[model samples]
Target: MLDLLKTPVLALQDFCVLCGRALRNIVRRPHYFDDIFLQMDIIGFGSLPIVILTGFFSGAVIGLQMTRALQTYGATGQIGPIVAVTLVRELGPVLSSLLIAGRNASGMASEIGSMKVTEQIDAMRALGTDPIQKLITPRVIATTVTLPMLTIIADFVGLVGGFIVAYYLLNLTAGQYWTPAYQILEWNDIAQGLLKPFVFALVISLVGCFYGIRTTGGTQGVGRATTQAVVVASVWIFILNLFITRIFVNV
Candidate 1:
């Protein structure tokens, strides 16, 4: 048990060292904007549709479920606030983060792992280029910056999804649907959800790049790193969700 615990401690230390080095590289060698732009496009813009689909389903489902439950008390109007709070507090950030993880994390792992296996990373080092600074730093920075913006888009589309279900399917007017939504929707809730995605982005980029940089074997190892990146980033995202929620509620 003690030995197993120490393993995690060692991993955490390594992760910290890598993160610090990557951060410094980002600051020192700032000419790597092209890679950063590509990372942003892939991690943020590329994943928009999946996040939209997720938000739509999550919002529709919430309305459907809450309507069914609230029908017993004839308080169906509460659906608006329910959707609002869920979108701003939970569904928006969580689903957006997960979508980004699926795209950015997997890609990051594959790119770095393949580079490692192809000896391109070593080639960079031989050419007096810093791989961490050039590759990992740009990726990590781009993802962290893009994630929060993606969450904002998710929240908007999610609310629209809820509105579609509530008014169109349920035979209500826009005013009736939006009344309760605006009542409970707060800027702080939106802020809280957006904040978590940035942290989630940091976690995703770091874990994916770390596994990729450490990859061994060949194509199989790269594939394994890709899978591990998605899985680990997802698990950490959900865990972070609980912690962020706890802090939001406390504050």
Candidate 2:
């Protein structure tokens, strides 16, 4: 019973230690520009299709649901601001983060876990390479840079998707939808949209790397770490979203 309780606490401590090392390495010399760019291409451009699809469908669905809700209030014309604010301030960052967590976090865990299991990470250390600097830092940098860019794309695509629904499906004019949406937005809303994803990217990448580097038990452990990485990252995204939202609100 005591061991069970201690397990999570120890894991959290180790994870924090890994995060600290990664951050410190990021600031130090010998930046791996090639690896960073490679990871950026893999993490950012490779994930675009899914991000686009998720954003478009999510916005369309929200538009559909919000239309019904607003109809009850005879305020269907207000769907623009409603959808805009919801997507920009909340849904865009949260949903995109969750999707990236599921996709990229699991991939990172599996890749690193495979290296650990196959002793490739050990070989790197034997050859005077720091796995944390070479493997983890580039991924962290790529994820941090790409997630915000992806969130912006998602936000734009989401708005466009909502506009399609509002203009065509709901028979609302472009002016009716876009004017109010643009009018209702504040700088704070945009800040919240952009900022939350940066925090979430850190959460996803670090959690994935932590789980991956710690993985044991050979192949089965790699699979388990991959699953755990996704689950933990997704939960952190939601938890972080609440705190970030509150902070943005208070500010």
Top candidate by lDDT: 2
Question: Per-residue alpha-carbon lDDT of model 1 for 12-74, expressed as tens digits?
Answer: 898899999987786695569999898888887888888888888888888988888888988
Q: Tell me the tens digit of each residue's lDDT in model 2 across 69-183.
A: 8999989999889888999999999999998899999999999999999999999999989999999999999999999999999988998899999999889999999999999
Off by over 4 Å in 1: 1-7
**TM per candidate:** 0.93, 0.96
Stretches of candidate 2 off by over 4 Å are: none
Q: Compute the lDDT for candidate 1.
A: 0.87
